[model samples]
Structure formats: structure tokens, C-alpha cells
Target: MPEKNSSSQLIEPEDALLEAFWTRAKNVAKINPLEVIVGLDSVSALRPSAYSLGDSSEEADRLCKLVMDGTKRATSSWVASYQAEDAPLPEVGELSIICDGSGTPHVLARTRKVTTVAFQEAGPEIAMAEGEGTFAQWKAEHDAFFRRECEELGIAFDPDGQVLTEYFEVLYSH
Candidate 1:
């Protein structure tokens, strides 16, 4: 006779509906930071800079156009919110983009407590710190909560996991 395994639990129908709703909402609100960088670079370069001259001028223009086009593509492909209110909520940390000498972008999420004095000196700093912290925590909590909810709903939680470990390692190494 074959040995029987007895640790499986059945999912409930009501839990399934809630999990589906949460997944959809979470999926709809994700932002691609690469698109933001592209957009900013594209928009910023069109304005003449003090260093624009000779051969460098042509290169600058080319870079600007490339960035703009790339950003446009990224923006269109990913759901991005430009609105201030729609931006990630405020918390206590930030996600920074780390670029190599070649200008390749990588995300580095970090947490730090801010002093009230620093906030007073720079109004925008406070908002930035909050947004970064909130976004990081939200992503973590959402993943755990969603996974548990899915399990309750009898749904497998594997959704093409993108490995953020490599990026974090690169960030910490620096």
C-alpha cells in the first residue's frame, strides 16, 4: 500500500473572491521607475544647457531624443501615475536608482529615520522620505498579505517572480 500524505487544507469560496479583488487592485497600481527617469531626461534635455557646444551638441541632442523615445515606450507599456495625489503614499524611507558608469539603472530600496530639523530645512525632503518608505513597506506587506490571501482562496501565489535579490545585493555592495 502507498503511504498517504495528510497536510493539505481546502480553500473557501468567499476567501477566493477577496483574494481576486486584492490582486487586481495591487496589479493596477504598480509604477515602473525606469519610465519616470526616461521621461525626466527626455523633458529636461530639450532645454539648452550651458555646456551645449560643437560635437557635444549633436551627441546631447541624440541622447535626449533616445531617452525621450525610450521613456515614451516605457510609459505606454507600463501603467504610470503622474499625479501628485496618485503618487506612492508617504512613510519613512526611499527607493533610489543606482546607475553604473555606463548609465544602466538599478533600483535600491533603503530605509532610514529622518530628523524633524532636516524636514524643516527642506520641505520636499520630508515628502520624499515618506513616499520612499511607504512604497517599500507597502510592496513588502502587499506581497505577504496577498500570498496568504491567495492560499486561503486556494490559489497558488507564484506570479512570475522577478528576482529583486540581485538588485538589492548590488545596492548593498556599493
Candidate 2:
């Protein structure tokens, strides 16, 4: 007659194998989206630029570093989130860098207005418009810069023809 294997009399070796398997399975389990966002935000805070002095002479460099670090952190978190589930995609956003007339760099959450006189002292005028011509030119340049930065960061923009202007408006309204 074959011997019966009862739970109470389970062998130590078999119990160890079962425990190890469970541990591995739990490690591979998906994390919640909210949890992923929290993780991303935490990671973002740990980045060097995230803590840099905004008024320092190296503000521009720091801003660039912040954007790069933030994007990388967010992307990593996003990938982890995606692996954990098959619904509710993470929202994507743009990073914009604009320079004033004095060549001082300002990081915009998205594309927005900056005065014309801000960039004029930097060099010759590039474009002309009424009311916010200088601001418009600054925006145009910032948009180009933002696109380049996104490319460098390897993050894809929205595919539905959303432009920086719309992005700025959304950001500003909020």
C-alpha cells in the first residue's frame, strides 16, 4: 500500500520547496498603479537636480538634470506598473526649457509665456507678433527645445497631434 502524505506530517524538504515557490511568486506579482505613482514620485525626489538650488548659478544645468532624472524615474515606474496590470495607462507629460534674454534658463512645466524683452538682449529678434511677440518667440524656441529634450530622454509625445501650446494651456489652467 502507498503511504499517505498528510499536511501535519509534511516533510521538511517539501515544506521548504513550497515556501520558496511562494516567495518567488509573490515577488513576481504586479504592483498597484497608485503604488507605482508613489514609487515614481519617491524616486523623483531622490534625484540630484530635484534637490538642487533653483537660484544657483547652475540652475540651468540643474533643471536639465532634474528633467532627465524625473523622466527616467517615471519611466521605470511606468514600466513596472505596466508589467503588474493590463489597464489604466500612465499619463504622459512634456518638459520645457526656456531661456531669458540674459541666457538664464527657466524650466517650464509645459510651454507658457515669457516676455520678449527677456530674450532680446541675448541676441537678434527671431520672430514677430502682436501683444506677446517676444513671448511667442520665446515659446517657439522653448517648444523646439522641449521636443529635443524629450527625444534625448527617449519619452514619446502624445500621438494625437497635441502641441506645446495646448499643453501649456492645460498646465496654466491647473
Best by lDDT: 2
7-121, model 1: which lDDT tens digit per residue?
1221122334333433332234233335547784332122111111012223334322332233211000000111212433222333332222222222222223323221113
Error of 1 at 120 (Å): 7.9
Residue 31's lDDT in candidate 2: 16
Clashes of each: 3, 2
Instruction: List the lowest-lDDT window of 10 residues for candidate 2.
Output: 165-174
